[model samples]
Target: MAASRNLPIGFEASVAGGIPILRVIHESTAGDRLRAVHGILNGTANYILTQMESRAIEFDQALQEAQAAGYAEADPSLDIDGFDARDKLCILARMAFGGRLKVSDIPTYGIRQVRAIDIHSAHRLDSTIRLVGSAEQTEAGLEVSVRPWLVGCRSMLAKVEGVNNAVFLLGDKIGMQMFYGRGAGGDATGAAVVSDLIEIARDLAAGQLSAKKVSGFLDSHDVGICPKPRPVSWYLRLTVKDQRGIVARVAEVIAHRDINIDSLEQEPHLPKERLSFVITVEPVSEPIIQRAVGAINAFEFMLEPVLLLRVE
Candidate 1:
């Protein structure tokens, strides 16, 4: 209650489990002109990667180990799948960008599907996998997406290691600033919550709280979601039951779609019952490849949906 905490401005904690952090300070606006915001907010992926590094285990196995250790949950989809990252991003975006936004409105893609092969590919190019939520000013609106990306080695953003959260801000004078540290764990986020509360109390005492203090998140233009997202290479993993004409059928599908296969590899020693085929495709829009995948999934002999990844 405002009486107990002397809260007239407000106090609302969210999906973050920081034992009620005062993560709200965006209400202050008497001077700030413009701001940029983002968050690296998921804990599961961070924890999984840390486990992978420590145990020298594959990502999937590391995630499983994290789940068993209670560092992850029964259904860690929220964390691993990218929703958790989006929620935290929503809060940060509202505070930093001064915009109104609902968590659901933000597009999200999880790292749950990232296999060791994908991570390996990222590193081969001197990159590292990171879950990033980005917002950039544009002619239409703010462009944003929560997805796994291969951050270039040259990017300081790439320097962020496992379980560490980092945020970048760019503005008139602020130029470029990064808030990097414990993205998770009770200590880091909990400290953030407490700090928020302190600022809220200070602002309320100074009569700086105003309901009209606006944010552009929801109000900002949708920024047209980068439709027809620029052509990018892709990684496709196909599982087959070792039936006849499997490879030929696949090639035909790719050809019909006007997509070029850059390289193809079949892991040696794969059992006849379950063979893994990896396909690297030249740069192309996603829909083109999705059609090909759709047709491939229709085959009864197809093991499951062919896994697809947008290559960096």
Candidate 2:
């Protein structure tokens, strides 16, 4: 209706709070083609992950702290489970890539399973964990997902902490640009809302209250998913009951798939009945690793399903 009537719609507060990211992608990049857009889109999830990294706390403890601090809701499934980020990613990807994206189509994984032990392991590897939403154009199609990534300590993504959010835009003319600020809060969101209102009012005064055609959002064509995502390093955390052949059995599954194990370390002092094994594997696609994980999960000694994190 708005489009038909040339009525302007304001939605800047819906995504990254006060960052004005939607405007930047919708207007500022008009002259350039965006190659990719990715970042830490959820402040609640980021707060939890940063707390886990800085205080060395478990996911539950960090989550409780976030809730107490008012950064997360009592039921934080939307934020912590990657769905919140997924919706936001859909908006950004459509704006940047010019396509119709189903919010449910994007694969999402949360930080609920992340543990203090995982944080400890990340530090050993000089890295930290972050929930990242990424959408990039590829020859096959658009490759997009929202998941926890094991980012290096020195990487820019790892530097975004607390309730802060950061977005990176890659374009042919702009190269790479980053927008950083408080992600979600009354102050940030209110400011964004006001800015949108001000812009709408100005346009009304100028007698130019016309709907801007955002290609991706307006286009009826569906975005395509990549057929085969490129291979990358992976981290697999397995909890198992310590048995005589546990290591060998797990190794055989990986070996059978022709995937190379980069490194394997078992946390010391864990009870024999419940042990945590961290395995880093060489670059491999998702399907291959899932196949290996499935075989390993079926073993009788396994206590829990494998927790997989992509090593960035």
lDDT of 1 by residue, 1-312 (tens): 334333333355443433232223333222333345555656567767545534556877987776776657778887788876676666555555554556677878877766665555555556556677766554445556687765666777666666666666666555666666555544464443233433433343465744243233334533344444446787777877898988899999999999999888776676999887778789887668888889988877778677675554
Report lDDT (Cα) of residue 248, candidate 1: 90
lDDT of 1: 0.62
Which lDDT values do the candidates have, in the order given?
A: 0.62, 0.80
**Candidate with maximal lDDT:** 2
Task: Name the weakest run of 10 consecutive residues (lDDT summed) in model 2.
Answer: 192-201
The TM-scores, one per candidate, come to 0.67, 0.87
lDDT of 2 by residue, 45-118 (tens): 99989888888878888888888888788899988999877877777787788768887899899888888889
For candidate 1, the 10 contiguous residues with the lowest summed lDDT are 21-30
Question: What TM-score, to 2 decimals, does candidate 1 have?
Answer: 0.67
